[model samples]
Target: MDQAPLHVLAGALCDREGRVLLAERPAGKHLAGLWEFPGGKREPGETPLVALARELDEELGIALVEAAPLIRVPWRYHERALLLDAWCVTQWRGAPRSLEGQGLRWCLPMQADPATLAPADRAILQALRLPPHYLITPAEVLPAERDFWFERIGHAIEAGERMLQLRLPLWPRESVREFAASLLPLARAHAAQLLLNADIEGARVLGIGVHLTGAQLATLGERPLPLQQIVGASCHDAAQLAQALRLDVDFATLSPVAATASHPQAQPLGWSNFQELAEAAAMPVYALGGMVPAQLAQAQLAGAQGVAGIRGFWSAS
Candidate 1:
């Protein structure tokens, strides 16, 4: 039997420099000594935003001014299930101090070690680190158009595309490896992360990350790479999404939110279905298939981490 999810509102109080405020659970409480985003359980009939505001005032002596939806984390902890509704509190009135006498720290997302955080808060940390747009390379890049594609990629990076996937399935292994090698420096120069699609060996050799196909994700029993390296997956349905979560993938892309020119025959999931699946996902999920940068806000409203696409992103101005 499934129990009703306990809705808890949490806020990532971000400073101007982009550090998030975390509070350590005090002694004699559940998960004591563990760090987590500061908030509390939602009172009946209270909205998540209202509950977050109340919690902040009570726990941190702060007034919530503005906040944006961050991520909704649904976690199962042995016998209990929780729905953590997180928001990025960008504008709050007072400086956050631990009014409850708990330890407080403000740190960059990457600096928030998972070992020191509550198990349920780990996914929120990952969500905070991920960018709002994911770019996927075309399936095949003609040799003659290589320079053109590179220029386009460079331009996109310059415009703040921080995460990318090179998915050249039809290219020779050696060719893909060489091309990825050449692109790594460019990606690094722009402070962007590049993931090799369905090429674990190449990714390992290149000291980069790998993006697993759905088939590869299903076959994996454990994480393929070290924790330091990013691992993402392409998931189409609930089963694949579960597998990616089980492997503890950094993120995953769920596709066909809208009909696509690339895969004309594939049916789109639509926003309603996308929301249903994404709400239950354990990790950050990017909405793919016929996606454009303009749809990012829409995707987020539908419980997605962001939007992902090939042509939509590559061709954007």
Candidate 2:
């Protein structure tokens, strides 16, 4: 595959009823007439959000008010590397019209057929069926702490944290399995879904969903997970984001919207740029990387389904 980097931004433009707008690429362009999230290419010295705002205004004649960070997918497309960032634009000026002359349509997955989208954007649509909010489980260490963890989890369940994950790094396999077995019941008892982080085998044995790391997303072979359960992935840029979407993952997390201690020096895409990415995504994107529950309103305004984190969300009880 070619490694040349292509930076692209897109949006999930929502109306009062939360329906997203999709646009068809005009004829004569690459992927001409292919449906895509409405946005454009990035220019040197222009941030992705700046490009999105400018593109939307020119193409649809609307002035965006609040756009938020959503999903960032980094993938290789047709031998060329692409970084697709998506944002959600909830507020804007003027009614949207297809000023560029491409067909525009509103999409709500429950009512629309998925086959119409460009082959590349199909995976994103599949992931959108998942619930907008997520509750990522805290990473724990001691096996003896199962009760301690479940106590807090039970409270979160009561408070409406319907999704959970088990992410204990490097614990013994037996202990992890035992812990997973223990948590699964509580999750089931409460009617919540439990997911395993990068542990498809564990999820299978435990009978739940799996959340893939960004690296594993590209390696998927025919989606081995059960069709009935959720499958999720972590994405950092457009390429990976698109891959997750293409794979029809149940949901995905994109991160480092702001710099975090986990990777102190990695270039962080702030919320403004995050909004641009979320807008273009066809899936429900969650805001991650240094986020807390209190920031959810701002995150939502920017186009995130919600926020996820290790530190910010672990103590919800």
Candidate 3:
């Protein structure tokens, strides 16, 4: 029989500057010298929130005032299994200090390098940096419509869109590259990330990111881009999710969560099944297919980083 996982509750404590706190593991402890979110084991009979509060008090010397669910990570290190349940702690009674002898630092989520974080804590860092909605451009193959799409993309960026993918399968690669390059200034101006769908060269050339199809994901044995560039994948089942995790992908889109017009023949995973597959993934999972911006919170509660969709996410205008 498999051993039960240890329940751990962590807090992403934020300061007025919008920076989150990180703690370097003290010597003599497991995974010592690595940086991680400040938290500890969940003792029996204590709820996750209560456990987080107690851990924050013991480790950081703070009394939790307000915290919201961030993400729950299911991870394994060799034979050791643990569930890293974290919350976004916005308010606290006292200033957080390193009461447990661990070094503490506060930095912007995107500014913190994931490699410096403890293995499982990397996912927490990603959750803090990534947005709750990943918007995908619809299939539009036309030289005449290029400007139109750019206008729409610009609008979305101005509206606080952070993550987007250029998934124009029918368009030529060079044209797509040029379009992505043209938008880079706008994307950068607004701190948005523009990822190309299945275009590794374009992404690498532009120093952006790539989103791998399930087929491409199966073929690659390692991460295609450098650590600074983000990588996402399209995953439908537990096996694809495993492949994504194997590649150490930053995030994944678990699609067909609900029936839709584009893929009418494909069966839907439904929220329950989607939750199961999402839980199994070591990285963040986004519910694709039949998703809208309205369901972001529900998706997050269901173990998803958020929702990714083509139609509902973009505006008609």
Candidate 4:
């Protein structure tokens, strides 16, 4: 028998310094003492935004002023199933007080201690950590054009590309390492995160993170690196996404949301199918394949954390 999904609205209220507010579940609640994003269950006839506003007002003595969709998390507990619809509360009024006697703390998203968070809130926290645009390097960069591509990537970083995947499969291992080594300084200078694609050993040797290919993702039974390391995967279908989730990967990219030059004959998932898969996923998903930065808004609306691409992201201004 299937359990009815419980709809809940949650808010990630942010202060000016980029700190988000989290509340400790009070005694008598199902997950007492665990930290979670604030807000509560939706009442009948209420929309998610209205529920969020009402819950914040009732529980925290604050008024929700401005917010945007963050992520919708559907999780199943042993006793119940829930659909947690989270929003990024960018602007609000009044100082938040824990009117219900629960503990409240504000911290940067990356600084969140996962051990104290409720299991259902983990994916939401990870989603908050992701940026709106994910850039994947071209698979083949000729030695003659290495410097040119490097300059292009640097320019993209300068233009505010915070997360990048270095996916040079055709390059020799040593060359890839050398290139990544050289780029590390520039990446650090710009405060950008660089992930090596399908190169676990190289990523470990470089002290960076690894983005697993679908094949690699299938072979892994557990996370390849520590929680502090960024582990992502390329997922072509729901099964791949599930495997990545089971591996506790930080994020995943779902491809061919639209037709692409790289695989024109391949049928794209389109926005509707992409949304279906993303909403079912337990981690942040980036819409890949023929995606452009301009499509980020649409992708986010469809439950994606962001849009990722080789040509579209790299060529963006």
Candidate 5:
């Protein structure tokens, strides 16, 4: 018989400098010698919040003040499965000290090295660094519509949109490159990231992110870009998602959560199926297709890093 997954609570306690606390596993424990968020397993009959508070108090010798659900990662290690429920703790009392004989340190989430942390903690790091919105441009922007896209994208960046994709299939590569360049100054000033759809060289030359097509993901033997650059893939099923993990891509978009004009023929992976796949993934997953900004909360509840869309997330304001 399959064993039930262990419910483990993890707390990401962030300090005022945006640094998060990490605890290293001591000897003889499972995944020992590795770094992870400070927390522990939930006892039976305990709610998630209560369990997290108890674990933090026991493990870190501090009191939980304010926390919010960041992401829930369902991962399997050999025969053992665990649901790593993570919370972002912004406020707390008492200085955190290692009470369990574990080593502790503080570092910025984005600056942490994935290889140094436990496997599941890498997903949590991505969750901390990524926003709840993944924006993709429309399929085709005509010559006349260029100005409109530029204006809206500029405004979006100014409005705190840090990541977006430039998917202009109808335009020439040079035109797309130029357009991306035009936005670089503004994007840089605001610390926004720009990605091109399946355009590896363009992204490489421009020093931005690359959203891989399924075909490209399958053919690549290893990560095409370095760790600092974002690498996303379009995934539809378990196999594609597995391939994405093999490549160690930063994130993937699992699509068609509902029927839509873009892919009407594509069957929707209703919330149940979407959540199932997402839980099994070791990296952050985004819910795409038939998505709107309003569904952000619902999508996150289903184990998504966020919602991704062309029309759903676009706004000049």
Candidate 6:
């Protein structure tokens, strides 16, 4: 029989060099001596952010001011199951010390190879290496001519777009599937992952992933979807961020890092704020809203995996 999952809060704290902090579990504890993110179980009625903040204070002797939202990873370990809620907390006070007298290490995300990680944490590391950038195509009606959209998509693929979200809102489901069937081959031919935006059926039918909108993200609970494909959502604040992290989603997009016409009213988080958020995120974050390819380097500097754009990514050769 499958054991019910346990809910736990986890942290991805890091320093200036892009090196993350990992704590060695103390002897005699569950998974003791194994390396894991430094956080503890969530208390009853306590939120994940609050739980993470409190856990960081207790385990690392630091104050976590803010954390970027992240994907949740739910896994079952022998006797206990784990619903791992994770975040990247960039802004903190003081150097981290192992307050619990466990060992600690700072290593590059890739360097923390899965072979050395605890079973549950290995999945988290696989998520960390993903490039932060995503290219969002406008969801407006495609040209009446079938070849037109495909030609343009071909150009985008040649320009190094490894991931794409096909989002034509009014297109009928059959039409969407037809379009995906036509274009996905081109994408797969180019080594890209084509994600169907908010089209779960289309994605599943086409053997692709689905990108959840913020509203859908807010309503999600335990996920039993097929594990072979990626699952992601859009997030805008600590609460939504916490929810995404608790769901063990594969990735997520956080937007308006800077002001854009796409969302004029949404206040921009700016680079400094983005930096703070990236530091705490357990999953690779892509800077969306008013972002451009030029910002990719700066995004990496700020701890993001990359930047996502619509106009900026599509504008030019």
lDDT per residue for candidate 5 within 192-292, as digits (tens), equals 78898999889889888999999998899998988787899999999999999889888999988989898879999999999999878778999999998
Ranking by lDDT: 3, 5, 1, 4, 6, 2
Backbone clash pairs for candidate 3 read none
RMSD (Å) per prediction: 1.8, 7.6, 1.2, 1.8, 2.3, 10.0
lDDT, residue 76, model 3: 88
Q: Best candidate per TM-score, number?
A: 3
Ranking by TM-score: 3, 4, 1, 5, 6, 2
Q: For candidate 1, lDDT tens digit of each residue in 1-317?
A: 88898999999998989899999999998899999999999999998899999999999999999999888899987888989989999999987888888999999986778778897888889899889998998887766676777788778888888898888777777777888788889888886888999999899999888999988987889989876678999989999999898998889899899999988998899999999998899789999999999998899899999999988787784
Question: Any runs in candidate 2 off by more than 4 Å, and if so which?
Answer: 1-132
Candidate 3, 101-156: lDDT as tens digits = 99999899989988889999988888888888899988865767898899899999
List the candidate 6 regions with Cα displacement exceeding 4 Å.
Answer: 1-129, 143-146
**Given candidate 6, what's the lDDT at residue 259?**
89
lDDT of each: 0.89, 0.73, 0.90, 0.88, 0.89, 0.74
* Cα-based TM-score, every candidate: 0.93, 0.60, 0.97, 0.94, 0.89, 0.62
Supply the TM-score for candidate 1: 0.93
Higher-scoring candidate on TM-score, 4 or 5:
4
Per residue, candidate 2 scores C-alpha lDDT tens digits across 1-317 of 54556777777787887588888878897778678778776878998889888889988898878887555555556777676676778888898898988889997743445556665454445444445457666555566677877787678777778776777775676676777777777677776777778888888887888889887988985565765667878888888877876777766688888888777987888888888777666566788888877888888788777787776677644
Candidates 2 and 6 compared by lDDT, better number: 6
Report the CA-based lDDT of candidate 1 relative to the real structure: 0.89
- Model 4 vs truth, CA RMSD: 1.8
Off by over 4 Å in 4: none
